[model samples]
Target: MAAGMLAGQVALVTGTGGGLGQAIALALANAGARAAITEMPDRLPLAEQTAAQMRAAGGEALALPLDVTDLTTIQAAVDGAAEAFGGRIDVLVNNAGINVRQPAFDVTEDAWDSVLAVNLKGLFFTAQRVGRRMRDQRPAGGCIINVASIMGLIGYRDRAAYCASKGGVVNLSRALAFEWAAHDIRVNALCPTFVRTPLTAPLLDDPVAGGDILRRTPLGRLATPEDVAAAALYLASPGARMVTGQALTVDGGWLAV
Candidate 1:
């Protein structure tokens, strides 16, 4: 890989077994950042495969097991990535998330808890641990990209828990950015409108839901993982050095109306 914008940097991306997390990790590695790809223990094999692909393309990469919901695992994963990447992590992508689609009136307490546990709660603790590491690192600066959703910025049916969790993520990124600015830590949220990933393919394949989404988007199409990955790349690159505490949307004009 030729030296790219992120050359010599180290990035830790969670939930890299597939989907947006995998795409972002590959993009960062291809851009010359050493990547630490992490996933749940059961998904470690898939993450390893992703790392292998990066390595085959001449990019430095490693796969680690991480369960964001568990504080012990979050700390361990952060420490492991930092240790593996020369004791510093230049970028952190808080991408581990889950959604339980159901009407607000029908949403069970368990469902809400599970969604928030992985989406909002997990993301917060992971960012907290990584932010601390970034603050104390010799350079005393780094970037954090939280993968929020356009649903976070707008209302939608059967997504009450998801929307609530992602909304928290958007605001949380801003709060963290404000508090960490003095440490030179830039925090931002990447809100992508309905990307076609494995986790979302079923919904996208539904004629009713899918058609409605396409109609609402001025661009007339759903987002691809790469579309969101590109935005994440910019946030992690030197080009966005002055950018912080903002929600960058890859919604294809979904909110234009």
Candidate 2:
């Protein structure tokens, strides 16, 4: 077998049943990391599909159903990745989140709570659980990449819930990095602009909002799932060993102008 930067490492990527999550998982495996995917049962098919693809590519892949909001389930899934691969879980990519795009005034308490539960609370707990385990392991370290959004750095109409959640992800990555540095774990965030994924597919069909997104982006286009995947790959690999607590933007200059 040929050697790569991530040779012999195991990676667990959440929400990878499809879209950006699957892309990240596939790319990580391609780079030599045995990959694992976590998603809710009956919610996503991409997790199994992505794992199968990785296996065919000659990479070890594990697919486990999970709910990031459920601490117990997530914890077990994290440990399972290590056990299944017969090695330590060297990377965790928190790619699960919900984007709510309703008018701020119309955003109900239920909407707020639902989004926060999954997007914020779920994200934090997953990191904490997986990070602690990694801290205690033989290698004594790992990488955590939280998927944020450009909305975290800026604002948009009808995206109050999304903005808040992603903003939380961005800052939480930094806070985790500070606390986990002593444990040899690196924490970082990826803030991508509106990417073409199932979550964003509806927006692309929306005549007004979709057009507006393209106009505002200096790249004059939306980012693809592959773009975010590349960013996740770099941060998870040894190439980003020195990088931590950064909300690396991959929005095609959406924030630049």
Candidate 3:
């Protein structure tokens, strides 16, 4: 693999306390980018641990606290990252999101709002802030990767809120890509099927839900964090210079059926 694909670049990835977010951050760092690993204040230690691992592997990394629900801190986080890395962030990975697994009717107003707030609203504002930074910076060219899900493309039984939020993310990526193309900023979405992460462990452990997921995926397997990380690396690298306003599905052929 080409380790220098992202050499000298700076990347900020949110929700990096564990799972896919941490995997993406580590992948970026391994690809020779200075990675900023961030998460909620309470999860800052996890981010730091990931950063430490990156550093141990001879990569540059920074750990920061970020809560996507708080709009006021978005700018600060982005600005701080840029300042820490010579005034530019080449990649923005909007990976901080949440889900509420409830049937449409059973979902309370609070559940709906919370899911949308982090998954949709937070993602938009974070990209907006980062897009502005990319636009204003000299030699402007940047990438934005939104971590959506296959649920956005299709539907699930008890994931009404999650499905709605992710579906919005899919379209939002397109809108941002269209509007930001002139600035040389590429915005894309990554849609992955069920992965065996802490976040999805509960769902994947259930006999019915897990069986359904496996049945739908032609490959009869779940995605690994590395699977999603590889796709993210491609989208962020120059190899995908022409790719934007697209959702790269990392499912194990779950959408094929």
Q: Give the better candidate number (2 or 3) by lDDT.
A: 3
CA RMSD of all predictions: 1.2, 1.7, 0.8
> What are the per-residue Cα lDDT tens digits for candidate 2 across 1-257?
12476888888899988788888888888889988898897764768888888888788888998897777888788878878987588899989888777999899998898899998899999888888878889969999999988888998998899899989999999999999999999999999988878888998899898999999998898888888888988898777889999999998898888
Local distance difference test scores for all models? 0.93, 0.87, 0.92
Model 2 alpha-carbon drift over 4 Å, by segment: 1-3
Global lDDT of model 2: 0.87
Candidate 3: clashing residue pairs, number:
0
Across 128-241, the per-residue lDDT of candidate 3 in tens digits comes to 988999999999879999999998999999889999999999999999999999999999999998888888889888999899889888988999999999999999988899
What is the TM-score of each predicted model, taking all chains together? 0.98, 0.96, 0.98
lDDT of 1 at 210: 94
Per-residue lDDT value at 40 in model 2 = 90
Q: Candidate 2: RMSD over Cα atoms?
A: 1.7
Clashing pairs in 1: none
What local lDDT score does residue 203 receive in model 3, on the 0 to 100 scale?
Answer: 89
